[model samples]
Target: MISHSRRHCVVELQALPARIGQIRRIVSAQLRHWQLDPLIDRAALGVTELLSNVHRHAQPDKTCTVEIEFRLGRLTVSVIDSDPRLPVLREAAMDALETCGRGLALVEALSEAWGARHQTGGPGKVVWFSLTAAPAPVAAPRPVRISSKPVREPARTALVAVDPGAVSAGMSVAASVGARPG
Candidate 1:
């Protein structure tokens, strides 16, 4: 039921500070290419937050995969890391003024929906966010000019022979409306 073609991109890299910025750029570029101009900023922010988490908290190593998929008028940006520990969403404390713990909060605010899921048949978990945007408008078909009039075909009736054994009784009853069987 998807009218527009879907797009997917995956980038595997060590979640270093430098690489996070690089992935942000790649995500932005891909969203632009998919004609999702409105989602670029939010998606970039979500990717940055997920990658930052991987860089700071993932175990075994800092390696991770950043995946971006667009389908059904929604864009999903996810990060998969070797750590199975899902991210904890801390409630914002009004008394605390720390700036470090606001990454996921920002992602939650900007995204339509966001969650983390344990990867099946793998050692890692994927943190993802969804953004809804209107699909790109379909281009109008070009108008063609015809120099000659369309030819008309003369109507003729043909007799069609039906085998009672070959056709079901229900089919024969339906075909008897206008069809003449010889």
Candidate 2:
């Protein structure tokens, strides 16, 4: 069976500085729950970059959403912004030391996988990334042994009969366990 853990937070703030604390709290908890802190740092950085980009680009009163989903072995964190403009991959020189061009580039380097796509239900698009964490090992189920001696074949594979009355009833073979009172 697949078990998924998930969380979502909405941010509708104007200033970038105001939302950092909230983002940190939510993202840190998710990272810990997923057991991916080492990789989570990169994810956090990516989230920060994405959130900052939203704040810089999206209009005021625009709402942004952050979501984290944890599967058995992988974790994904997505930031959905109101802006329909998807993030563009830019080719910048590594040593250029550019002030503004390094945000998304840095995100790309840190995350295992990161990209943007249009949101399915709404007009705006979602910019998101996925990170895989070490999966918890599943213990194998123990096998059961059945006796080799053949007994009376059961009428049904697995069945339990109950008469809806005040009666003592039992099934027996060579020994009389209890007689059903009808």
Candidate 3:
């Protein structure tokens, strides 16, 4: 399920493998609707990582709230779960063949800033990351040049066969006839 207001979207769901994919699609669509197409991939990936964390590690329940909000030239994605434990940014080396333990690291590399905190007056924690959003391009006004002098129309010119091309002898004699509107 999803609900939203201006510049914000919230989805409540069980963080199962199947539900995570659906949430990614929802997040992508929301970004596209807001004309933030460029942020779709990053935002979707960040949300996926957060949701996966909830599915893998959260205790007591798999239910979580996914929130995506845009404000002040930044896009923020958060996953709030009932577990109050904040996530740690693991810097320890992992096996080359390891497929897990790198989700948060990827989020950190992709986002401009990211962190987690315990929810105020709640039993859950919100893990969130923020990406810098570029402002939508606005059409710039074209510059106009004004001159005090009156605009001059182009002169019309025609070639006249002066002396009938010098009697067809090719004497290279021609005259230009110019005309101006009355």
Candidate 4:
């Protein structure tokens, strides 16, 4: 069951060069508002790559949905597009310096887990990645009292010595004279 505290944000737009940056900023802002600051950079990067893929490859339309969900101590960033093709993760070659094929590679390296799924009963697919957030610190359990006992008061009183000369300047002259010894 999904908890009521779960957070979710979604943006639907054409995955174009201009919209990618706007979506990245939106994703960053949502993560920040959710107090998932550590995930912002990675989430933004992953979303950028996913949207770029949509821009370059999605069929019929470049329109897509970007979704962010925080649940079960994990933050998931996903992009759903009209393209039916699942993404292929190309192995990073030792000497290749191509800029075009590194999107999924970077997503795999940065995310805890990543995958693509064909949308059920639909003509599109959803590509997603998850990052595990550090669990919130559990509050220490408070001590509970099972029974009560009679309280014992101190048997003696402590007397504190006071110096008359050390009294505040607000003291009346007559009161100071009366408090002093000849």
Candidate 5:
């Protein structure tokens, strides 16, 4: 289940292996609804990692709250658990077979900024990451150029030329059409 405001969403659930997948889908759908399709993959991945951490390392119980917010051109995803202990970002593992300790590292690479801290109004800690969502700068429209000078064309008269400036300036310039010599 989820509760949401105009720019924020919250989900409270047990961070079990099964529930994690559901939370990911919820995040993706929310982003799509907000017209942030580009951010769906990154947000979903970051949320998954945070929830997995809650399931694996958080103590006491696996219950947690996930919050997703879009504010001031940034999309932030956070997971709050009862565990007071903050997570430490470990160095990247050297072996390809290693899979247990790379969650935080992956989050760091995917997000513009990320951190974990003790909750301001509670005992637990919230692990959060932010991705930049600023819209691309729009190119200004090119100014339309209206030429002040008029275009001149050769008159159909056998030996006459028309001055475009005189005609455009309300001056009359007449030329008699002559028969062509075949």
Candidate 6:
């Protein structure tokens, strides 16, 4: 089996008011690249709410980081901050709407999965989420069809069978091809 990993960013959040647009742009770019724009809009909204809660409820000035891991079949976004308290999940009826208490609840409903974890060797928590299996790639642009002629298929692509109960995708791909890039 094989694993893919990527490190994203570390940013200061002393100016959260100015960071909304920046956050939105980064998330949009990543989602569009991953072909997950359908949920990008929703994720963006939820992420914004999450960040908003961090900014408002946490200390007055702090450094926060947004880390995203994007791979062939999964994406995870984590916001690390210097706060020890894990986020709370409460019924909306208990809290007034103006205090931004609904952010976590909204995220719960929108995300595939999310949670807060205490950072190792540190004094804070990392609020993170997991997004799975981006959408299929978009077909390249082409000229308009002028006739009903048959289309030519692309070259060098292979059809690999997939088993319903395969334990690992990487193993399956390697078994099918016999070998792969190191």
Clashing pairs in 4: none
**What is the per-residue lDDT of model 1 for residues 1-182, given as tens digits with 9 covering 90 to 100?**
11224588888899999988988898888888888998999999889988988888999899988888887888888898999999988886222677676778888999989999999899989999999997678899989986998788988877666656436655663466456554
Q: What lDDT does each candidate get?
A: 0.83, 0.66, 0.87, 0.85, 0.89, 0.69
Q: Which candidate is the best by lDDT?
A: 5
Compute the lDDT of residue 131 as modeled in candidate 4: 98
Tens-digit lDDT track of model 5 for 11-118 = 999999999999999999999898888899999999998998999999999999999999988999999999999998877542578878888988999999999999
| Model 5: residue 117 alpha-carbon error in angstroms | 0.4
Give the TM-score of each candidate: 0.69, 0.62, 0.73, 0.70, 0.73, 0.64
Q: Record all residue pairs in model 5 with backbone atoms less than 3 Å apart, i.e. clashing.
A: none
- lDDT of candidate 5? 0.89
lDDT of candidate 3 over 1-182, digit per residue (tens): 77999899999999999999999999999999888998999999989989999999999999999999999889999899999998987785245776878889889988999999999898989999998888878989989986698879999876563554344665544322232213
The reply for model 6, stretches above 4 Å from the true place, is 1-12, 93-99, 134-144, 147-182
Candidate 1, poorest ten consecutive residues by summed lDDT: 1-10
Which residue pairs come into collision in candidate 6? none
Per-residue lDDT over 1-182 for candidate 6, one digit per residue giving the tens place of the 0 to 100 score: 11223434344454276786687777777667655677677767766877887788765355677766765566677777788888887786235545657778777777789898898889888888776755577899988977786888778767765553442654665564655334
Model 5: residues >4 Å from true position, as ranges?
136-182
lDDT measured at residue 35 in model 5 versus the true structure, 0 to 100:
82
Error of 3 at 26 (Å): 0.4
Error at 123, model 5, angstroms: 1.4
Superposed model 4: Cα runs more than 4 Å off: 1-6, 93-96, 136-182
